[model samples]
Target: MQVTLKNFTKTFDDTTVIDSMNLAVNDGEMLALLGPSGCGKSTTLFAICGIHRINGGQILFGDRDVSDVPSQKRNVGVVFQNYALYPHLTVFENIAFPLSVRGDSKPDIEREVRAIAALTHIEELLARRPAQLSGGQQQRVALARALVRKPDVLLLDEPLANLDAKLRLEMRSEIRRIQLETGITAILVTHDQVEAMSMCDRIAIMNKGEILQIATPTDMYRAPVNKFVAGFLGNPPIVMLEGRTSGDGRFLVKEGTSLPLPARLAGMPGDTPLSLGVRPEHFGAAGANRVEGTISFVEPQGRETLFDVTLDDGVVLRSIQPARDDVVFGQKVVWPLDAEKLLAFDVSGRAV
Candidate 1:
C-alpha cells in the first residue's frame, strides 16, 4: 500500500509534536523514520496507525483518506519496542490472537497462524510460552502475529532495541528478508543510524517535529542537504570545523590552518564563515595537501584503528585507518584531505 501524509500536524495542548509534515511511503517500500529520541518519529507512526489523531492535514492509503479511521480498522500492524506479548499465552495463541479477535473461523485462524509462524521461523516454538522463549524468538513471534493478518502496512517502532548486538544484526537481515518476501509496505522507527542505513530502502530523517530530509541511504550520506543531516548520519560522526573561505581557493580554519577549497567553492566571497564537515574515513596517510598532527590516542578496532590526533593549534581530530601495531602515542602523523569528500555549510547550517 502507498502511504501518504500531507501537511500532517499533531499537538499536545500548546506543544506541537508534528508540524505540518509531509511524506510518502511507496507501495511495498520499507522506509525508516530515523532521528534521536523525542524527535516525533514515533508520534508520526502512531498517527498513521490511528493510535494518535492528527490535529491537522490528511493521511491517505492509496488515495483513500484514513485520517479518521480507527486503529483496528486501518489494517495496519505495529510491532512495538517492548514486544507486548502476553506472559500467559502460548506462542500459537499469541500469533492467533489477532485472527481470533476478528472472529475468523477456527480452521482459518489455525492455518494463517501456522503459515506466518513458519515464515518467521518460529513454528518450532509454537507450543512455548512467552517466558520460555529467548529474546530473538519472542521478537519473531511478535512479527509473526503482526504479519498473520496480512496488513497493508506494517509499523515497527524500535523493534530490535532489546536484542543483543549479534541478535540485532541477525534480526536486521531477517526483517529485510520478510519485507521483501511478503511485499508489504513497512515503516521502521529507529534511533540507530546503522540500523536505518543497513535495513531500509530509504530513510526520512526528522527533528524538532519536522521532516529534515528523505532519501536513499547512500544519497543521504554522500550528499546531505544540511549540516544536521550530515552530522547525524555517520558513525563516529562527521567532524565539523568552523572556518572561513579566503576567496582565493582556500579555507582558513579556526586554528589558523589554511586548506585549499574545492573548485566549486572557489567563487565564495572572501572571509565567508562556514562549517567544513569531513568523515573520519576520509582522512588518510600523508600525501599532497596533507595536514600534520600528533597522535594523542590510538584505539584498535579489529579491522580499523581510530586515532585521536592533536593539531599544532591543540585542536583534536579523529581519523580512522587500518589497524597498525607500530603506532605510538605522541607520534607525529600527517593525513591528506579529500577535497571532493569535504562538505561545506553556511552559518545557517545549510549545505553550501
Candidate 2:
C-alpha cells in the first residue's frame, strides 16, 4: 500500500517533535527512518499507526485518509526494540494470541501460527517459552506474531538493537529475506547506520523532527545532499576539512593537502568558501591529490584497518586500508584522495 504523510506535524507541550514533514512510501517499497536519539523516528511511526494524534496534516493509506482511524483499525503491525513477548506463553501461544484476539477459529489460528513460525524459521522453538529461547529467537517470535496478521504495513522500531553483534547481523539478513518474500511495505526505525544502510531499500534521514534527505542507500552515501546526511550515513564517518576554492576555479585543501575537484567543478567560482569531505574507503594510496599526515591511531578490523591520521592543520582524517598494510601510529604518511570521490559543502553544510 502507498502511505502518504502530508504536512505532518506533532507537538508535545510547546515543543514540536515533527515539523511540517511530508513523505510518501511507495507501494511495496521498504523505507527506513534513520536518525540519532529523540529525532522523532518512532514518533512518526506511532503517528502513522494511529498511536499518536497528529497536530496537523493528513495521512493517506492508498487514497484513504486514515489519520483519524484508531490504532487497532489501521492494519499495521509493529515490532518493538525489546521484543515485548509474553513470557508466560510459549512461542506458539504467543504467535497465536494475536489471531485469537481477532476472533479467528482454533484451526485457523493454529494453521496461520505454524505458517508464520516456518517463515521466521522459529518452528522448532514454538513450544518453548520466551525465557527458554535466545534473544534472536525471541525477536523472531515477536516478528512471527507481527507477520501472522498479514499486516498492510509492518513497522519495526530498532527490533534488532537488543541482540549481540553476530545475532544482529544474522537477524538483519533474516528480516530482509522475510520482508522480501512477503512483499510487505515495511518501515524500519533505527539509529544504527549500518543496519539502515545494509537492510533498507531507501532511507529517510531525520533530525530534530525534520526529514533531511531521502534516497536509496547507495545514492545517499555516494552523493549525500548535505554535510549532515554525509556525516550520518557512513561508518567511521566521512572526513571533513576546512578548505576553499582558488582564484582560477580550482579547489584547494590545506598547505600540505592537495585533492583534485571533479572535472565538472572546474568552472565553479574560484573564491567560493567550501568544506571538503571524503569517505574513508575513498582514500587511496596513489592519486594525483594527496594529504600529508602522521598516523594517530590504527583500528584493526578483520579485513581492513581504520587509519586515523592528523593532517597538517591538526585536522584528523580517517582512511580505510587493507589489513595487510603495515601502517602504524606515529608514522608519517601521504594519503591520496580520488578527486571524483571528493564532496564539497558550503557554509550552511549544503553540498555545492
Candidate 3:
C-alpha cells in the first residue's frame, strides 16, 4: 500500500500538533518518522491509523481517500511500544484474535496463525502465554499477530524501545526482514537515530510538529538541508562552531585560525557570519591548512579514540582518530580540516 497524507492537520485546544504535514509512504517501502518527544511523530502515526482524527486534508491508501474512516476499518496493523498482547491468551490465540474478530472460520484462522508464527519463528511458543515469553519473544508474538491479519500497512510505534541493547539490535533486523518478505508498506515512529537509519528505506526528520527533511539515510547524513537536520542525524552529532568568511576566500574559525574555502563556496559574501559544521572524523593529523589545539579530554572507543581539543581562543572541538594514535590530554596537537566536507550555515540556520 502507498499511504499518503495530504496537508494533514491535527490540533488540540488551539495547539497544533501536526501542521499541514504532508508525507507519503511508497508501496512496500519502510519509512521512519524520527524525532524527539513532542515532535508530533507519534501523533502523525496515530492520525494515519485513525486513532487521532485529522482536522484537515486527506489520508489516502493508494488512490482511495480514507480520511474519515474509523480506526478498525483502516486495515492497518499496529505494533505498539509495549507489545499490547493479552496476558491470558496463548501465542496462537493472540495471533488468531484479529482474524477471529472478523468471523473467519476456525480452520482458516488456525492455518493463518500457524503460518505467521512460523514466519516470525515463534511456532514453538504457540502454547505459551505472554508472561512465559521474554521481551523479544513477546515482541515476535506481537509482530506475528499483526502480520496474521495480512494488513496492507504496518505501523510500528517504537516497537523495540523496551528491549535490551542486544535484543533491540536483533529485532531491528527481524522487523526489516519481515517487512521485506511481506511487502507491506510500513511506517516506524522512533527517536533512536541508529534504529531508523538501520531499518528504514527513508527517514523523515521531524521537529516542532513539522517535517524538516526526508531522505535516504546516506543522503540525509552527507547533505542535510539545514543545521537542525545535520545535527539531529549523526551518532556523536556534528560539531558546530561560529565562523565567518574572510575577504581572501578563507573561513576564519577564531583569532588566528582559518582555512581556505572550497571553490564551490566562492560566491559566498566576504565577512559573512556563518556556522561551520564538521563531523569528528573530518579532522586529521597536522598538515597544510591545519589548525592547532590543546587536548582537553580523550576517550578510547574500541576502534576509534575521541579527543576534545580546545583552541587558543577557548573554542572547543571534537575529533576522532584511529585508536592506535597516541594522544594525551593537555598535549598540543594539530589537525587539518576537510574543506570539501565542511558545511556552512548562515545566521538563519539555513545551509549556505
The TM-scores of all predictions, comma-separated, are 0.98, 0.95, 0.97
| Of 2 and 3, the candidate ranking higher by lDDT | 3
Over 4 Å off, model 1: 285-288
The TM-score obtained by model 1 is 0.98
- Report each candidate's C-alpha RMSD, comma-separated, in the order given: 1.1, 1.7, 1.5
Q: Tens digit of lDDT per residue, candidate 1, span 1-352?
A: 9999999999999998888999999999999999999999999999999999899999999988999989999999999898999889999999999999999999999999888988999989999999999899989998998899999999999999999999999999999999999999999999999999999999999988888999999999999999989999998888899989988989999888787777789888999999999788877653357888899998889998988888898777778888887878999977786776788999999998
Give candidate 1's total backbone clashes. Answer: 0
The stretch of ten residues in a row with the least summed lDDT in candidate 2 is: 249-258
Ranking by lDDT: 1, 3, 2
The sequence of per-residue lDDT tens digits that candidate 2 reaches over residues 97-133 is 8889999999999899989999999889988999999
lDDT of 2: 0.88
Residue-wise C-alpha lDDT for candidate 3, range 1-352, written one tens digit per residue = 9999999999997998888889998999999999999999999999999999899989999998989989899899999999999998998999999999999999999899988988899989999899999999999999998888889899999999999999999999999999999999999999999999999999999999999999999999998989998898886778888888886778887555676676688677788998889788777643346878899989889998888888888877788888955778899987887777878888899887
Q: Which candidate is the best by lDDT?
A: 1
- Which residue ranges in model 2 land beyond 4 Å of their true spot? 252-258
